[model samples]
Target: MLYPATKVTLIAEHFLVERVCALIEACGGHGYTLTPVGGKGLHHLHATSDRATLVEGFDHQQVEVITTDRAKAERIAERALKELFTNHSGVVYLESIEVCRRERF
Candidate 1:
């Protein structure tokens, strides 16, 4: 099996996960996967508390998108920054990756 694709990683305030996904879709990305995350930023801790004894819902989230086209990856990054970064804590990066099924991407 062979896989060929590019991966983009986006880290942002958890609250913006939905918005980021929307931007990715608008930019022609097929879809994205999200995972809850916790870390410290310049001014504050992203997650450090318990809500009613349960881990305070995720304060950060990491979003990843796999694409076959570089342009689509760039578009997704740009939109996520424009629509989310200014007012929230976030970072976006791109990396080359190999996937087994080119058609799936």
Candidate 2:
């Protein structure tokens, strides 16, 4: 059987993984999937010349949480943006989805 749900996705600096995971759990997300990801965006192009060194590639993480409650999903996304994304390079988005195994979420 398919169950309706919401998927919240957060992509941010690798160092923020722990905090992000904690936030997810605190916001009623029972579980999540984490993966190391790499990409180039405005943050890369705007690197300041003052920095003596530059670290590139795979410096970001992708955190995904699927839950049956849309409010819980929105809460996760909103909190992440307000509490975490300010002054940080990150993005949070939510999508409607269907899960085959509802209990797993």
- Candidate 1 wrong stretches, greater than 4 Å: 1-3, 42-57
Summarize candidate 1's per-residue lDDT along 1-105 as a digit string, tens digits.
Answer: 766678999987766788888888888888788888755551143433544433444567889999989888988888777877877778889999998777777
Backbone clash count for every predicted candidate, in the order shown: 4, 0
Worst 10 residues of 1 by lDDT: 42-51
What's model 2's lDDT at 13?
87
RMSD of 1: 3.8
Candidate 2 residues 1-105, lDDT tens each? 999999999998877889999999998788999988766552543455543233355668899999999999999999998998876778788999999988888
- Per-candidate TM-score against the hidden true structure: 0.79, 0.84
The prediction achieving the highest TM-score against the true structure is 2
Error of 1 at 13 (Å): 1.4
Would you list the clashing residue pairs of candidate 1?
Answer: 2-100, 3-99, 3-100, 4-99
True-structure lDDT of candidate 1: 0.77
